[model samples]
Target: MDQRSELSEFLRSRRARLKPEDVGLRDHGRHRRVPGLRREELAQLAGVSVAYYTRLEQGNAQNVSVEVLDAIGRALRLNDIEQDHLTHLAKGKAKKKRAAACRPQQVRPALQQLMDSMDHVPAHLIGRRLDILGWNRMAAALLGDMSQLPPQERNLARHVFLDPASRSLYVDWHGKAIDVVSILRLCAGCYPNDPQLTALVGELSVKSEEFRTMWAAHTVAEKGHGVRRLRHPVVGELTLAYETLKLPDEHDLSLVTFHAEPGSASEESLRLLGSWSADQPVRTG
Candidate 1:
């Protein structure tokens, strides 16, 4: 992907989502050509020159300072994830060349044991491209049997977009799909030259129209702690809160654990699902 073009589009998309009144600016009587605040207005809000902000938005500004970027982020009303994404885009051009082939990341046995110990909490390990590197039995029960899928098909983004079962698995499929695409966009900025990521994006873009449209929006988001409503085949609907923990030493591997509030129906359902998963034959690869 062209980093400059991606950066330009991302900034434009964010800028278009905000209005003059959003930042307490009075709406002028003049007819506006664009949807959001004009370039000059944004520049004024960010305390930068119109020409400099314009150049930054156009992807021509090569030396972006942290303070200036932070000001722009605040002016744009960006969240923490979006702010991080902006920083990534600004620095992405300086990334060195990666290896021709992306190396497969292995889950540590200790980490696997840790996941297994959380018997009631559905947990899984995901690599850079959202690949399901490892998962516990409860995770398999909640999100479908990852062991049944080929390694290449074990990506969360792939399953969310291509797998028909995912439509039934996630209660808010469209919303989840949008979040997945945004996460992928953030990943793309971080690893602009990863061939595997490029291939995955190309494949999904061709296969799913929804994925294609969301991908084109240029939104970027880091995966964070959130609640998800999932429909289990056996246990019906479950409202689970999940936390994404990034492993510092694991080469972009993250452990995502899902659980439910105590004494809730979802908690009971999760316990039942855990029992059911425990009864099934343990899967070995």
Candidate 2:
């Protein structure tokens, strides 16, 4: 997670995904050397000088203004999440602080209690780097026993990419993998010098070729809500709709809750699973 390199690469990757025609620029029928808009073309679209934009893309620009970032974001057709990521990288380019040491994340008591009270729903508290900081019995039953894993290994990214069980658990395994990589990419932009994140990314990159490829794509996303189809070992196949609830005071923590549609087979299966695992212990990392 070299911040400067990440900033430059993120910009290049974003630029490489666009075409002149995509941005309302007509091609003059001349042979183009690159896949996307040239630097000068982008500079013109952003209403900035070529030299300035080139320096910005190279991660050498100092005192970058938010207005310029906004202009470049609009020119590149970046979404709200992508725009925030770009701004984070751009703002972090001038930092000189050393990466903070890795430490165990603590789950708040109130949050843990709330998750535990959700007896019928699968719920977990996710910390920085998608770490499963705390989980109730239902979550353990649905997503596997996180208590069996080491502290550092209790992460969603690790489950999605490194664990074989996840491939069977998730019907859309590839889509889940893509979402994990995209979420990690967005986190990387925000926590540029996080040592734990650096280690997690390195481990996944080494163990999973798919992770490597997706990481190179530099897609970024902030997961809000989604549907997940799971093939549970005990309950059989079930589809669940999930929503992310960001903790108000804990900026780095989110409570994820999943529920099946009312009166559906999936709902029955989920209830069955919950009833079957009622005695299991909650996993609090």
Candidate 3:
């Protein structure tokens, strides 16, 4: 969870993905020891000195200006999320490190009621570290039975990486795994000193090679909106549109909901799943 290491790796990974030709630098077909743009090539593209760029890449963001960082980000062709992540890493060193909140996360009664009102939609309130704080019966039906899991084990990343059933559940399990790692990377940048996050990363790295590889890539992401394809054990194939709603609270919790297109086969499958979930015990967590 070293911020310096994270910064350096993020920058290095970004740099390694770019080529001299990508930034209008002519590749003079010369022998090179590495792929992508070299440090000097990146500095030239960013309109900065090699030494200065090297120092910045070495995690020395002390007194670095936003313009300089933006220049670097531009040279790397960073997307919006990547640029935001770069900015977070650069400016994060200025803040004092503090321990992560130790309190257990809980869903507000109002929010829980709101989730319950969505009878057919699958909703889960996800807290920091991708912890599944609260979930509705529909979510439990679509996903697994979270009520049966210990509170500590109800996490999206853990479920994706550790659970064997998750592989078959997600149609594109590799993509799902990458998304989990990217989300965790975003969380890590926001809270570098979070012991729980550190432990989660360590555990996944040791247990799953795919998690380790994706985590090393440092692809940061924000929960927004996307489509999810799943092969449910009971309902067969389904395509669910996922959306995240951020909660206004001390804990960084967001309600994630999945929906199916109206009048589609997926919606019918969802209805069947809802019916199946109705008979099973409702999720209490």
Per-model lDDT: 0.86, 0.87, 0.88
Q: Which pairs in model 2 have colliding backbones?
A: none
TM-score of 2: 0.94
Local error of candidate 2 at residue 64 (angstroms): 1.7
TM-score, cand. 1: 0.91
Task: List, residue by residue over 39-146, the lDDT tens digit for candidate 3.
Answer: 998998888999999999999988889999999999999998888888888898414434444556787798888888889999989998999988888999999888
Model 3 TM-score, 2 decimals? 0.95
Candidate 1 vs candidate 3: the TM-score winner is 3
Top-TM-score candidate index: 3
Number of colliding residue pairs in each model: 0, 0, 0
Point out where model 1 deviates above 4 Å.
93-101, 282-285
lDDT of 2 by residue, 130-225 (tens): 988898889999999899998878999999998999999999999999998998898888777777889999999999999999999999998689
**True-structure lDDT of candidate 2:** 0.87
The C-alpha local distance difference test score for the whole of candidate 1 amounts to 0.86
**Candidate 1: pairs in clash:** none
> Per-residue lDDT tens digits of candidate 1, residues 54-130?
99899865888989999999999999988888887877642643552266678888999998888899899988878
Q: Each model's TM-score?
A: 0.91, 0.94, 0.95
